[model samples]
Target: MTTSDGEAKGEGIHAWHRQAVNDPNPQTLTATSAGHARRRPDHLAVICEGREVTYAELHRRSNQTAHALLAEGLRRGARVAYLGRESEHYFEIALGCAKSGTVLVPVNWRLTSREVDHILRDSDAEVLFAEREFRPVADRLRPVLPGLRTVIEMDTPGSLADGFLDWRAGHAETDLDPGTGRDDAVVQMYTSGTTGLPKGVVLAHRTYFTLMEHMTRAGLNWYDWHPEDRSMSCFSSLHSAGMGWFMVGFAAGCTNVVMRMFVPEEAVKRVHEDGVTVMQAAPAMLRMLLAEPGATPDAFASLRKMIYGGSAIAPPLLRQCMERLDCDLAQMYAAAESGSVVTCLAPAEHTPDNPRLGSVGLPCPGNEVRIVGRDGEVLPAGRVGQIHARTPALFIEYWHQPEATREALVDGWLCMPDAGYLDDDGYLFVLDRLDDAIIVAGQNIYPAEVEMALAEHPAVAESAVVGVPDQRWGQAVKAAVVFHTDQRATARDLMVFLRGRIADFKIPTQYDFVDDLPRNPTGKVLRRMLRAQA
Candidate 1:
């Protein structure tokens, strides 16, 4: 084991090592609730859909929940899956799993029943927690999955004799320690790979604590958390973007406003009415929120910072958010395997005209980013290649997939699925996913770079680029474009608009006009779907 800087792994203080220094802060995920409860018993910890949960109440409830799990014969490292939207019960169950040393698996509600069954069976989940919305699907799959022993209803009592509240209330509230270690796995999130097969990414307890404490101790204020700040959990907990941000809010002892789902109108209302000071949203979600008629500057006046990631944001939309919201803006670049934010574009560098805006900012303290050529050798600055990251907070392995794990983690560095490069100034420029790159005449062409160029045109709304077989060029660039309702541009017009912005060889030779682009649940363009259509 080694640190990102090639030093001995534990040469410096780490999140787990902080306890040895006599620090009072929490070092593990379970302690987040216990520590905050003792400091501010009555302070609101979670607020969702008119329901409020204080830190003390959350602690006591989570304690009962943990006892209930143990009483159900679930041993440490058992997989407990939750199928539902974000709610107070979801966080309660997460903390309960953390306390009981069980691994929590969150199922995306948008997934098909087959996908859900695959995850449930693959993880060998013993206990399932389902909200009312997904009860039907849960019921259909329960009898089929032999390993699934228990199903706890989230909204109301369904297959189980007692609902989530009744079941949780049946157990005693006395806090119990299961001797969980920082190295123990707490959460297992499934990532759908390029083949559409999902692999569980196993994250340890320290994954959530160590890097955060390191950055905080390093005095990095890219995104600050204050006790008075109210943060919104807008992204799905199934994804790292939502779960990581939620954990961060809890670790900081701030109030977290959880949304059932991201509705542009509802998100806007929450921002104004809930007095949300911090928000982490994807660029596509931000675009929809800004398009709402109610998304006035005053509606966002309460926001202290707007953090966007998950995918690239067009500079035009980025400028719109900065101008309309009138708040500090930040960008995060990371993967679920990385455990925490690897690089961040801080508020100080968010100038509209800054050339570095194309960059994803510098690496966080104690983290390292390097580009590697196909031969596994490091590349110099400004050359695009595979992005490899080394950080204290990283997933231990892909659950039950040793070969895949070996391929991803090489020599203490996690090879990111995406392709990118590091600038001379240490900033990161992410081009596109390696799988999504188009090879034209032995030259690499990134779709995102072309999409960004198209976004600069006033008539272009959104676009997706893919490669089509060409007899002469090996593969030629083709674009599926959607224009703004009030704007229109010819294919020649777009070709001319992108003439100087990008290379002539990278420009799309053929274009297909469409109403909109297809995207997945997290607002990422479905390039594979576009490729098949092409």
Candidate 2:
């Protein structure tokens, strides 16, 4: 009943399965999904925007997409950037790239041309799959991304050159053995940088199933998906939840209800119409779904389990959601660099009378997470410190940034800036302030990155950004600035200027004009004091 470290077991849920998690030869997800297609070819594998795509169709089309890419001269481990929302085409392209030994980089469609250019250039992605709506931004990026010669538009109104279906139709199903190894990179997710630019976290294909398989061997029920389960994925495809959960569901041979964009009313309606049993939703989305007109407890009665995390949920809201949905609530805590869900708050501990509801449950099977102090020593229970997680799911490296990778990943552990504490019961409490990184709608917005964007305006002397609690987005970004004495700038003007530099979610929703910013004796800005004032 203990981990390899000899720590007492949290849920003791490991005895449910008697098999092993790791394999002698691990490989890309294409193998797993392909097996399902062979075993159950006629099964409904994907349902998106009133269309149902079967497993056989998905596998065949992905093979074609892979062939299309190989014809364009993409080699093993070439990066392919996808700039669009959730769709069958997105999933097809992802699996196709994996089959071809190419890495898939899903870019946030909300980002500006500058942000998109930074990611494409940083990852050196040779091909881009963009939707028609983002064609203008793609056009702007083509001048900057010199190596990016291939652009396949999904859902386009124009000719064959600008659309994906036309491009994919020209190629046959590629049965070529790409000979991809387990350690090969498959996806590169960009984390908003603490420095001026974002850093791409390179993850191998094994990450999608490693933690879940380990949890399965350990007897955990919530870490996996069932073949009969209808899973709804409404989160932004750019985030780990969107693509990560989809791949998990696909591996399980489940029918996934994919949302092109998360419109709260439409999401709830789909859950009801599709008989969605499992879902990966954010707290904000859940709250909105519960508040929609004619939304009753019965509307969500079919849901068997709901997995949510990212931002901290208010106790009353969490309790309300569990009661309204009439389903077991599972909370998972993880980040892009960590690769997969490291800690899972099981459904059994979510009762109103349980004190453990405040915590993010126990660490999941096969991951090592410890709270370390300033002296690099592990802190005891109930003591808050930065969390260091050592897992097989950890990103291979921050793409091309050796110094940053070395700085973040030491030895085998990803030493995260997120601060929290584990109680004697092994329950982890992830604080709202995840190391000055403001999470707005599950998107990570680092204050340092936002402050740098604000300082770009000539009228601003200095700026500080902080996360203020918001009901809708969980946390909203706010700015406090000391303007240049001779210059004039309104809050709106600064925000307008910043909107051009950073993503909209990173831009401050509110601003405060201050004559001076508080500082310590060493002259470092006292963010804690600023937080206290806010």
Q: Which ten residues in a row have the lowest lDDT in candidate 1?
A: 1-10
Q: How many steric clashes between backbone atoms does each model show?
A: 0, 1
Judged by lDDT, which candidate is best?
1
Tens digit of lDDT per residue, candidate 1, span 65-168? 99999998999999999998888888889999999989999998887787888889889999999887788888898787888999888765453224788877
- Give the alpha carbon lDDT tens digit for every residue of 316-376 in model 2: 5676787777877888888888888878887777778988887787778888889988898
After superposing candidate 1 on the true structure, give the runs of residues whose Cα lies further than 4 Å from its correct spot. Answer: 1-26, 157-162, 192-194
lDDT of each: 0.85, 0.77
Query: TM-score for model 1?
Result: 0.94
> Among these predicted structures, which one has the highest TM-score?
1
